[model samples]
Structure formats: structure tokens, C-alpha cells
Target: MRPIWVWLKGPLPAVPWPHSESRPDVDLTPEHVVVVGASLAGLRAVEAARRLGFPGRLTLVGDEEHLPYDRPPLSKEYLGDLPGVAPMLATAEDLRELDVELLLGAPAEALDLTARSLLIGGESVAYDRLLIATGATPRRLPGSEGLSGVCTLRGLSDAIRIRAAFDAGARVVVIGAGFIGSELASSARARGLDVTIVEALTTPLVRAVGAGAGAALSALHERNGTELLCGVGVEGLEQQRGAVTGVRLADGRLLPADLVIVGIGVVPATGWLAGSGLELENGIVVDETLRATADVWAAGDVARWMSPDFETLLRLEHWTNAAEMGAHAMKNLLDPEAAEPYRHIPYFWSDWYGHRIQFAGVPTGEPEVVTGSWTSDEFAALYHDGDRVVGALTLDRRGDIMKYRAMIGRRTSRREALAFAASRRQPIVAAAG
Candidate 1:
């Protein structure tokens, strides 16, 4: 509840709130660009639009009061001992610099996309270029401990509550062993707090990283002393006086904890765009250019564009890809410069325990693994698609991974690409080296 200082790109004194637009607000005009969902991608999109000489009125609407801050820190720096320097993506004053009209604490209830306006609370704001950056919300479980301490780590408020609980020396029980869940467990363990991660899946991060990477991540968590419980479902939550005390697993087990962090996954916040005529699958279905059919564009966690390598239209939740896609959307909005199809190979890095883990590209289907080592612990295994590097797992290898990502773009044969494993140097952190 306290407005802690978030360092951001510069030294930002902490002020609070939280962006996106998928539905094009055609009624908007310098005149106006109403950006829904004041989130990472939303703020970035706002900045990019203004930077690219968007001579228009800008209004940023969101459901939360917290300003544009980085979500990744909720698991790493913010949750850990690192303080007074947490990097918030954008600050309130930053909005002033961009001349962006701020509408905070107002939940956008409905989207009149046809009328090019948003019915927020009671007011209707008409816009021209609407960017639906409504990011995903935490998937809440029914009858599960809806307690004061039972929380999720997605937005700023969620992180603040969890941090306060951790600071108070609460033993945290994290349900679901996905990315956010695993990262939360790592941070809690790093703080020397008792932490247990419960997952119904056989392997943690099975959906996100697949089995191979999940195994490595599990090992990392084990090394950090985080309890990883898999293939167990949560039947219900133990509550007393409306406060969660613990969770009951489907296996007839009760794990005791004062604080519970549920990071099951996120559902795309495309509910406002419902019946808006813009295709909304898992996310807003955008073409290669990050455009969702009409003049409306989509990016970040909410905007699911086509995956060129997969040869299928897919929504990506990776931070790197989201940022890149936002940039691409901005470029296209200004004046698209790409000749061929606009494709960005997905990449993500998680700082857990003592390792800054990074994964590049999608590893959905059967991928032939090239090279890796668990003990010495420094390697990069390229995932080959018929002799072409479709995906790669990088352990401590930073620089070469960039080149490997470029190789995926060349459409090279998988066999020829993986042949250089022995000759190449191992994975290195981009910052360290």
C-alpha cells in the first residue's frame, strides 16, 4: 500500500497507477489517441507514438491506479532485498513530459468500438487511434482461499502486497509452478523465507518451457531450496475469519502457510473487445504487422500475432517479443519499413537463484536438441526444425544466443546449424560479459 520508490530507466520518485488498445477508437483524433490499459506495452506505445511525431491528443485509460511500472520486477528485484532502485518502466511525470492525459482508477467497463469510444464508469471518451493494451488478469480460482493474504503477482498492487507479506517474514505457499509462480518461489526463498510451490502438472513450466527446460528450471529451484510439488491439485483453501491460512491439495494434503500467492497463469484481458468485431482468440489475432484486422493494432501480452516460424497464428506472452512487437507496431503506425513479413523470434530471460536464465524462440513441437550440460552449467542447445534452428536453450550463454536468433531468421537447415556446437563458445550473460 506504500508508494515505494521505483528507479525505472531514470531515478523515478514513486507515484502510483497502471495500458492497451486492441479496438481502434476511430472517433479519436491530435485530436486524440485513447490508449486502454495503462500497462508496460501501453506506456511504451504511448511514448513511441509521441516520439514518432504523433501530433495528437493522447489519453491513457486504465483500471488500476498504479503508473506504468515493470511487471518482471514483481518476482525478482522488488521481491528480493534490492530496494530504492526497482526499475519502473514509466513514471507519472514521464506522462507529463509526453503530454499524455491521465485517467487513473477508472475501470473501463465497456468498449463501444463501433462508436469509437470507451464507457468507463460513467464517462465516455471518444478517440481516434485506440490501442487495446489491456494486459492479462490473474486467473482467480472459485471457493479457493479468497483471503486477505491470498494473493497473486501480476500488477503493481499485487507485487506490493506480496512484498509486504514477505518483508513481514510470512511463509509463502505459491500455487501453480509456471513462470510467475516459479519466479515468486525463487524470490521468496532468496529472502530466506519458507516457500512451497504446488503444481497440478507433472513438471513445472510444462506449458511455458516444455519438459526439457522445465527440468532445468526445477533443478535451479531445487538448488535455491524452493519446494517444488508437481502433479498435485489444490482441492480448496483453508481459511479462518476470511483470511487464508493454507491450501488443501487434491491428494488430501494440507500445507501450512500464512501467505498464499496464486500464479496459475494469465487470461488475455480482451473482454472489453468482446462483440467488437475484432477477432479475439486467445488474444487479439493480428497479422504479421501486429495489426488486428482493421486500423486497430495489438501488441504485448494481450495482442497475439502470427508466429512466422510456427506457421500458425499464435499469441506470445514473452517480454522481449512483446517489447519488439510494440516497437514494430509503432513503426508500422508511423510508416511500416519492413519489406518481407514482420517476424520477431521470441526471447525471454528469468533471473532465478543465482542464474540469469534465458530462452529464445518457441519450443512447442518436437525439436531436436543440439548440446547442453547440467553440471558445469554453461551451454546453449539449439532446437532444430529439419536442420534449421527453430528454438534454442541458453544457459549462461548470452552473446552467441543473439547470433543463434539471427540464424533462425536465415531459414538455415537445422543439421548444418547445430553442427557448430563444439566450435562455439558457451552461453554468457549479456550484462556480465
Candidate 2:
């Protein structure tokens, strides 16, 4: 059937359709829509499809038994003593209202694109359309398996165990000084636990927001009484009677710890899609429209798609990107012919020792502090590539971060960004070389 494409009203920037000839013969009105991975992206896809008046038999599949819950809080708020309640993405009644067949604890085993079926827990489910949002799995430390007191914060269960350890006054050693690792250290310090962070790079988050900003932000750890060890590699985990006791550094240093949190990073959860005829690189390779194959669409951390704005392929593991990409992928799935290219300006925020660190766009170089100095707690900096303002970083400047985000989206020049920052009446610092 000829698909009926409905163009939603919005002020989205138009870009050239790069996959006009590769557009799939999709059934806009499918009989069944199956979404794999019931996390944020998958849940949002299900919700968006139902909200858009899709009257198909909808199924949401998840490996975890629990319903979709907020993951960002797992490393921060949920790990604290006052974890109010589980940050559930949807309630039972909400799912019932949407007529969703929720399949929990049954992970998708494999995909049969030829038969248009999914194998899950020894059962085959047929579908006319599919959305893969399996997300990513936390990378584990080699030779540390089967050891107690070693944990990675990816879900609720992990958070609960870590919180229990914190309550018991465990000495914490966090590996990798990324967002999750940094937040874990912050929470550990807040609980009055002895905490130390070990990062392999010369400066934590140097790859994300450039060396200058990363070094500046890493200072928050030292300011909060947490030991920050950079440029050190972990040899292995020291174990005592099948429980982790400390981290053994490659430089013959043993950092004692009762609990170890590994926040290194995550790998795309595309193992099940291996040999499934799907293009897989570091993740499930999708086009600008988030399409994998003829009728299969991928989103969230599992899908790496082309970014029309940057004219490159991006695979973001942030919550904002997952949530936004989920909804966008659903819209494109519903209206294939008029599918809009996802041109998201990546944004992420991290809380460390009562400081809110927010960054927007892609960091191309060392940030130029346009307003406020690096010594001060409250400041806004702009990152530029030549003349174009490619990114912005702020510490506790919550009110002004969005302005820079918009500036990055509009491809605003560095001069204009600096002028905008100067208009705030704050003393402007000289631009970085």
C-alpha cells in the first residue's frame, strides 16, 4: 500500500534527504509493532506511537523484570539515603491505557528479518514493524567477574546494592572518571565514605569537553575531599574470599576499598543482532532516519545514525539523546516518506559536589571563557572550531546554558556567542587560542 506520510507541525530545520532511494517499503499502518528494549528510548517509542493514534498490536520487550525506570538518578539521587521512590517511566495503568503488551524478563534472542519474526526466550513473535532500542550494557573490568562488592550502575538493582554498601560505610574506589564515575564519587563523599577515583586519561572527561574544561571540572573532586588519581591504569581487582577488597593499579599501587564501582563506559547492546543481517559497527548502523533495514528501526544507545547537522555519524549514550531519538524514530517510522533527519545538538548535565556541570553541542577545542572566570564556581564558556561556536560548557550557570545550546544549534559564530555573553553585563575573559 502507498504510505500516507503526515508531516508534524514544528520549526525543525530542513536538511537534504540523503536516503531517498533507500527508503523502505514500510507499512505506515502496520498490524503489529514490536519494540525491543523497554528502557527510556523503547518506552518513549511505544508512548509516542500510541499517542500518535497508532491502533496496532503493540508489544514492548525487555530483559529486566522491572518496568522502565529513570537511570540518571541511579548514580546520584537513587543511591542516597533518601531515595524516595523508583523513578518509573510508566505505571501499570498507563501501559494498560495504551494497550501495550508488556513483555518483561524476556530478552530478544535474535531477529529473523527474512521471516519478520523475533526470537525471545524460546518463543517467536511476528511483527510487521520493529523498533530496536536495546540500549547499551556497561563494560566490565576483566578478571573481576564473580567478585562481591564490585558493581556497575546501569539499572535499579545495581544502585540498590551500591546504596546498601554505602550505608554500611564502605570505602569506595570508583574506576573511570566519566559522568557516572564522577557522580558515584560525589554520592559516596556525600555519605561520608572514603572515596577515590582512578582515571586512565591524563584528565577526566578530556575527550568529552576538551582538556581545559575537563581539568577545571575535575577539580570538584578534590574540592569535595575525594582523591582524584588521573593517568593511572588499573591492573586488576584485589579480592578477599570472593569479595573485592581494593583496586590494584598498574603502577604497583593498591587503593584499598570495601566497595568498587566501575563506571568505565558501556558497549552497544547489539550482541543479539550479530549475524542477523543488520549492519553492525560499534553499534547497529542506521541511516539519518534511524532505519536499519526494510522494516526495522533502531534508536537509543544501540543505534548509531548519521547526524545531518554535523554531517557525521553519532552514537550518543546520553539520556536526552535517547529520549529525543526514541520519539523522533517513532515519528519517522509512522511517516516514512516524510521522515525528518535527526539533527540533535547533544546536551548532558552532571552533578558533582553540589555543582551542576552542563555542556551542549560537540566540543571541538579548548573552551573560551566568555563570562566568569574558571576560578569562580559560576561561569559560562564557549568552545569553537575556527569561527563557529561548536559547543558550550557551564558550571552552575543553569539559567544561561540554554542560550548557548540554541546558539550551537543555529551554528552561531564565535564572535556572536562572545557578544551575547558580553551582553549579560558580566566581565568577559579573553578567548583561548
lDDT against the true structure, per candidate, is: 0.72, 0.85
RMSD of each: 6.7, 7.1
lDDT of 2 by residue, 1-433 (tens): 1111111222212333234334546445777888898899998998888777676678888888887898998888877768547789887767777778877776788899999999888788899889999999999999888899998988888988998999899999999999999999999898899999999999888888878788888988888999999998999888889999889999999999899999899999999988999999999999999998889999999999999877788899889999999999988887777788888998999998889999888888688887777777678888887888888899988878899999888989988898888886343333331
**Candidate 1, which segments miss by more than 4 Å at Cα?**
1-30, 84-86, 334-341, 366-369, 374-376, 425-433
Candidate 1: residue 113 lDDT (0-100) = 61
Predict model 2's lDDT versus the native.
Answer: 0.85
For each candidate, give its TM-score against the true structure. Answer: 0.86, 0.91
